[model samples]
Target: MTYPRSLLRAAVLAGMTVVVLVQFAAQLVLMVPGVLLGMVFLLPPPIHAGRVLVSRWRRMFANWTGRTVPVPYEPPPPPPEPDEEGLYRHESTLYKSPRFPAFFHRLDWLMKDPATKRDLSWAFWFPVLGLLPLALAAGPLLLALWTWVWGPPWGLPGEPSSGAWWATAWTALWERPAWLAALSVPGLVALPWTVGAVARWSAWLLAPGVRRPPSAKRVEQTLLAWVRCAMLVACAAAEVVLLAVSLACFGLGFGLGLVFLIPVANSHFRWLANMRRQFAEWGGVRIPRPYTPQLRPELRPDGLYRVKNNLYKTETMATFNANWQWTWNDIASWRDLVWLAADPVVTVALVGAPVAAVVYGGWGLVFPWVWTELFDADWSAWYGAVAGHRTLGLLVGLALVAAGLAVPRPLLVAHAWWTALLLRPTKAAAAEAALRERVERLTQTRTDALDAQAAEVRRIERDLHDGAQARLIAVGLTLGAIERLMDTDPAAARKLVAQARETSATALTELRDLVRGIHPPVLSERGLGDAVRALALDTAAEVNVAGELPGRPPAPVESAAYFAVSELLANATRHGGAERIGIDLRHRDGVLRITVTDDGDGGANPSRGTGLRGIERRLGTFDGTLTIHSPPGGPTVATLELPCALSSPKTSTS
Candidate 1:
């Protein structure tokens, strides 16, 4: 009962094509049934039930193909989540516009083609005439096949291969009235078979288990569907007749009929195709797969056969039939189209001078008398001889014509360039948009990072000032009091002194721990180079630091660079599985560049950890940055750049 969408589509297209061919052989009268059959057969199923039927059909197909072939239907992609404003945004224009929906709905109605009222027989007459030529073109292939299978004459080449003798006898009969009335047996058979095929197709289309009628709830729905289809067929038939009459009446001017035929015929065919595909889909028939679109022109020459090949070359035709018309929505695509249109105009202008010269030169030689008559010039004197042949005049005339043709190229090119410029997006607008997005992102990141860092600093400062500092002050006061009491009461002083010693030791340890927490003493004493060396030495890493500053930089700059380098080295050793590290430092023109590179398992993402972010934030204060380059394999490089005065330390304190 139900068909695959593709199968229905194919049947509809195939049937429409066959009907069109029949019309081409016959006349407009035949096109009515063709249209009716196309619409009735191709009509898609209604919504809810249609979806259920399609799903069931798909499963059935999957099973039939032994699961090798995939289900025919591809579920629509999930819709985008609603934004903060609660407005839903769809990706396609079809979802957004009612006009497209209405257009397609009208097409569906035209395709359904229910019979509410019958059209006058004359209405179908013209379509038959229009389809006649196309049918004739296709007739030979079928006729040849029939002749080969059945001994109906029109036999195979070289000798009477089956039906040759019978065809000859029938041809002889066609010359007489009785024989003509009887007709060639082969012709009669083929004609009846074709017609019967069409009628069967139309009847099958009208039957149930195929396209169902529109819902009965809407009073005018069924009637309207029928009327719309009738109107469409009538229009198509009338157009065909009008075109024929135009050709008959005006002769050469009949070419203009295509203007009417192109739009209407294409729409008709499209409607027919959709219906066939839909019905076949409902009826579980498999349609041929669609081709991908061609993004570029093919390499073949643009001759008739080549063009035909290109048109049918799956992808190329797909691209042509697709919605690729250059629209103003996307500025880049529109601009390219503008430039393409403009280029010919520009070339024509620049080509004019040379073309004019050639034309003039050639014309002067052939028509010298005309030049004299038209311009009141003496051609004999132009030859510059006593018996002049107007050679000079001829040269000038030819030059003038050549110049006239040559002058237009540049003008045309300029015009074309101007037109393209008009279509092109303004750089200012694009730049402004980029700047806005950049600023917005940067502001959000900077604000969050700063807020986090400030909270951390306040917590550290409070710990040091309140807890450690207070304990140290208490210990100092106790020791001072014990010193004063030692002279006055030796025993009491001794006891006080012991207690003071215990307090002093505890306070001293706490102070040292706090100071270490604030900033490593090793870093200050030995400088960044030694701190890194100490880290590598302790961690058992093969660390190499080349181009270490011979002297320390400004304290803030040195501290920032040292910490940044230390963090990278630590990360590389811990996570990178790095066997070796190479560190480089250079100072030039008030800028310090430090690079720590490692040969390790790479693919390190800075966003995944705070180590890199901390390094970045520290460098931010001094207008510096840390850049990480880690791809999917080994060898990662971390570069830290800071604006500072670079110098070698004269003394080593650590």
Candidate 2:
């Protein structure tokens, strides 16, 4: 059986996280120097540097949880402008002279920021909170490994009996040490749940979004309930047939029949359920599993009684006990037998007819000739030897040939409809399944958002490293050369200085462009509406704009919305093939809606290119929706809606 992906994720993440946790503990050592710097020198560069390292830790936490954390520290106020002589003096003065007021201000701002504290808290507690699930997922595999390698030679911890041979350990599991094989079953089942759960817990703490659309979720649940119904019916029908076989075998084979009645019936029921689940899945329905919570071994009366009885309790014997009620409770398995028995008879024909046609129609013609030639027998002997000699032999052969040519596509269609009838889930199950799917989707998009942010940061870094930073270094080198040449070659010094100035100016412009590419300054300074209007000013097409939110959204949402519009406008300009475009923005009832319409060639689809899909995926992170309505030969309209309220005490500006 395949393990659930959640368990695999939990196991892997937990292992890496354990190492992160150790590093996380080590990070607290930063506080010692941080406080030391805070007390002595107010404007300490080390303190800020330490925080930057901690921000990386915070990002790791966010990634595991599938939530993106925006860096909270404000960008340092722009450096003082140059004087008329083109000299920058404020950088020297801000830190050099007299009072430590600037230092105090910097320290105070770092200490006061809420985001800083959130990061610190997350670093310390995430390991504690996340480790339990991780352990659960990883524990079974570890135990199995121990048993497989060591338990065969020597029994576990206290057992005195010599362990079984390695050959019998797994294959002939019933003879000795069968529990080793048994251990693997629970291990596979335990691990797959933690992936989404960890993600949800992380999101809740970091950046919880809105609930899924109830209507859509409810429909999914309904579909799941129907699948359960199908499986139940199949299980019941299959069980009935198996039950009769079980009794018949028991009557004939006696004690040896124990294997038939239990294993045979169970295997058949399991197979039916598995098939139903697959069929339902093929029809785009997720079967809702019946949730069962187990009683803890330590707290359960059965465990306590066994302990009190010195582990010699005969009544605790698991098998060879009468428990018809236990069997009766397996409603799901039995219910599936019914569906299995009724599983669209047409499905068998749908699958079988073509196979028959291939087997006989393709291979049929040669069989008779081969038999006749090899044995030196005539057709009459091959056909009439089995049935008394008659003129009907040729007709029988023709009928057999005709049967192979049958193609029953209608049966295939009927089988599909039959599958659809049973696999649809109920409202509640659909809602629950929808939530699971949404959680998985939210986690994915959150990861994408984080990745996008990281990519942007890297782009900015590269621009500085290769472009602006390199330019600045060149300028500094030129300045040093000019300084040395000033007394010796005045004209050469002036010419070099002028080139350095130009280099500095170019680097500054590149820096500004990098910043704008990340999050436009216009979007922050003037709200999304005006920011978009500013964007349109540079576009080639004629554009009209309307509507505005009363206040700004969270920084991340605003940034995503701005880019979403930008992407749409770009698509319109490049591929839209139109002269005019319209933009509308409206915020009401805690949702921001943006509509972009272009009088262009209509047939626009996300599948045709990455741009539209990229916009949709970006908006999806904020519990947002993107709808595109474009028909051939006309106008195209795209609408984006995000579920976020504009109620922050201070408007967020990125």
Candidate 3:
């Protein structure tokens, strides 16, 4: 049953081969005219049609083979959207109508997609390669039919056979039964194998992502490295021209006293240097920009702007002068000039030499052999012939190309090192940058801390007004009512007094609860470790407390750490579905460290939860840090560290 089904599927695939051939032909016919006539809109339709056809084939193949083939194309770009001015934007151009922009975008999508090329290649090759399996599947069946119709063993009754070449050949085969059986048996045996082969062939090109073999990946990386080397060489040549322009600008600006050109040259060409700095990452080095912060002119009390000792009525002039001074005084600006001058020389030596060797060796020495051999041209000094020997030139060219391929990656690293030598910030500049970053972080954390404090104050005020203060006012009103009722009705006044007493007790409880929120008494007296143990007793999950501190941390640090741990435990129980949790606290080297580990469904992220972010802000006020490591499964570990000195332990007095 399986054999018959396999043979039938193979036969169906063979029939589908004709459809593939027609589609391939139609694509070529459409593509040539589109290419010649500059009608790009004509190109995408046929390619799109071919993609649809191949996609069906991919689905059929997957179903028969029981192996999935994912779609390889990137998602199509969204339609052009109107900007704030109500004009549609595509690339840099603003369009009044989206029609042309949409058309061009679709054309670019079809042309640039890698799957378009793969689909076209598959269409052309599938029809050609499908022939072998077609024969394996349908050949034996056709032979048997021919024998049944024209030969003696199973000849059709009263049927006249013509003397065509194919008919006579089948007649001869039927007479020799052994020859006929030998031909039919193998194709029948190999039918299932043919189906497997077709499935494998389709998957080879149709699978998504990095399904290509490792050898192909290596070849791709090598080619990309060579291309990068060539690009670096080209950039080197461009830098040489820029260097010459910079020299001219410097000479004219300083020598002729036309000083405006100095800033103009520096500001205009600084982007090229920055681009190289970014590109250095390809060679495994990071070169940060070394320029100092831009300086701004200060506004004076007299409504004039001050740049140095000069005051100007208008801000624009003062700003220009400030920028000029800033650029002029920066040491990095001079380093930029030095790099522009030195880079062309260094790049040409390290990167350009090998690239040029490959280009000249391949095109000059090896490739010209085609002209020499086919066109019978003269082989002389004009075309990289060595001592007029094309053979020797070919060998040397091969050697040079091999040497070029072997050295590009190493030389790229060397060039990056040279770039870093001049482009990276000096030690003093690095320190200044670090200081600036630290100041910015401190400013942000200060804002967060102040905001949190204000919110806490508001919360405390609301609790007092709505809960304790209101309850106390009710108690005072009840006492006044009891005093009024004392003379008229003694029993009613006694009941009122009892009600007032109960109300006062409830108000006192509310006040105590509010005070506990402000500062837990357990944390103040017994310290953080015991406070956490008391917290654990209230939590639903089983909580284990371990480790001990030699002495208590500062009151503020202890409060923040306790709240952080409390939040973690609440999250573990409520959101994490945790069954067990552990808390460890220890002080080492003036740093209070607490780690909370939970056995839960773990994917804890600080960015996703306000509780975690609040904890971070609270800790940041004390220059502490929180680190969370929670993978997808169980066991989330959150570590909190605060740098502070511990005070002496408080003695317990009974």
Candidate 4:
């Protein structure tokens, strides 16, 4: 049988999420075991099993949207380190536990997992959110069907509770043909459109979003942002309503405790925070300058609390009353408060009002007319009273519905632009932020470089300890034994000397391997070209190298490029399943560029692998870059570029 339609997929999913989604909000208490029990024993296993349940929903979303949702779970944190001889003072790696005197780590992945939180949000919102779009699409049809099937009670201005309303509705419809045209025609035609809208809604909320890059056109960006911002605004609206009701209780000389509950209800809700960030990003507003209030840490003994201003803030609160001066010094906070106050107005104007108008005007206008046509005692009298007006109403309603689809985009753009106008930082502020960000990046780059250097040193130490040094020690013992035996036993001495010779050769090989790992001797003597060619020769796949440098790159750049290409070649041969590979290296305009292409099983993601991430971090130290293009199915291309000059004439061989 063919797969079920997309229309039913969400509802089917709603049915399937028995424990995970159906009563998720109600059953959230179950997570206590999943989270708290992680400390006492191996609770992560069950927690991981929950990931299996979440994967089902991901599949459902993918099936509906035709886009694969990448699982967003973070890799497990590193296990505790052990000391010499695979023992520890008090530690345990998740993999090897019994070797150490370790206690259960109190911090559970369950409590901090982003995937789990996303799953929870999806579960809670799917059923509730799906209702709006589905209802919009199907609700009108159902209402029309209800009216056509079960008419209004008794008659116009008549009994609504009457049981015989359906019989009378049919009789009234038969007498008046205009009732069917005006009522049922528009809704039936609009069914496809409403259904599609609802589908997009579901896709946006449930499916992994196809996120747009920052450079996308402002209009398109705002259109998508509107969807996300609308959801956030809706949540904020709920909080507002609750807080209002709470405030009103105090006004009534009742429920005085509600006043105290306001902060508990209002503080640190991330929806508004998220919306603000979205506004700043999509609306093209520069990020606000950060304010650190004190030299001391922001955290308090009790909990996290950010001080709101720079230490010894000097800005005057000109409008501050003497009594309120203490609270009013920071104008940024007050500005944010104003934004909070005006949120409802902006939200309605930008999102809620326009949508309602279109939906109601196009599909909703027919309802009153349907009732009037079906229940009117004198159809001819009412019809004869208004003739062209009925046609006028039809034209207007159709226009409204048509405008509904087109106007929201323009409105969204305008709102974004306005937000940008209000929230955009001054040019001076932006320049400062830019400088600060650059400084931060450079600082991080330096740190990464140091870390890479430290790691390299440790690696070299490890190699010497395991390979060259051990082999040399063995060779020394073998030579010592041979010398001791030479005079005493001549026949046995010859065998000992032969073993010593073999040990010396093995030790020399180990030293060569260690040197190659540090920087290939070919790379130092012959430069990058022969080094890459030599690497290709070692791989099983057919490899070709082209292009020549005017001169060789600096030693560090050459070494980095060789290692990067080596990694790529290894990847292609092992994981990529390549049969053939091409390497093209050239130096142009003081920058050396290396391009590697492989015919292989593709779909390589640099973000997913440690090797690629490490390469990127390594390159970042020298302002180098790696760009990967590997579409699924076959063929992969990786481009590595380094900005540096070459040395004198370089030696090379294949």
Please report the TM-score between candidate 2 and the true structure.
0.41
lDDT per residue for candidate 4 within 543-639, as digits (tens), equals 9999877788888888889999999998888878999999999999878899999999775655334566667777877789999987654589999
Candidate 4: list runs displaced more than 4 Å: 1-274, 280-391, 485-491, 544-551, 582-609, 625-654
lDDT of each: 0.50, 0.60, 0.81, 0.60
Answer with 2 or 3, whichever has the higher TM-score.
3
Model 3 over residues 320-373: C-alpha lDDT tens digits?
Answer: 899898888888888887888888888888888789889988988998865665
Give the alpha carbon lDDT tens digit for every residue of 1-654 in model 2.
Answer: 135556656665677567657656565565655577654453245446646655665575577555675555533322233332333332223334223433444454566545455545555676775675655645545555665666533442342232334433433443344454465565456544555565555544443222447986876655444344444345445646755665564465455645435434433455545555565554455565432121111223554323222332344432212222233344444444455455535344344554444344334434554454334345645443235432344345455445533433333344445654544444654676678788899898998688666766777788889999899899989989998999999999999988998999999999999889988898887778888999889889998998877888888899999999999888888877768999999998888999999998666655444567668778988889899987554589999999998854344554
Evaluated at residue 27, the lDDT of candidate 3 is 92
Best by TM-score: 3
Superposed model 3: Cα runs more than 4 Å off: 1-238, 251-258, 275-288, 351-416, 484-506, 541-548, 572-590, 596-609, 628-637, 649-654
Per-model TM against the reference: 0.32, 0.41, 0.61, 0.55
Worst 10 residues of 2 by lDDT: 290-299
- Residue-pair clashes per prediction, in order, are 68, 38, 0, 1
Clashes (candidate 1):
68
Candidate 1: residue 297 lDDT (0-100): 32
User: Model 1: per-residue lDDT, tens digit, 1-654?
Assistant: 223432343344344445434433443334355466664222332222333433443343344333432322222222233322333333222234334344444333333333211111212332453233324334444454555456344432223223445545544442333443333344334443443343333333322223435553343543333333333334334444444443443343245543333323222223322332332332234332121222343334543223323453455554443323211133443333343334334434434344445445556453664555433456555432223545455656666654544444344334334433433336754565566666776775577567646765876778767776777777688778878887888888788777777776776787786676566687778776776676667655798777766677777677777777778888888878898998887877777888888998775654434567667777876678788887535579888888777455764564
Question: Candidate 4 overall Cα lDDT vs. reference?
Answer: 0.60
RMSD of 1: 27.6
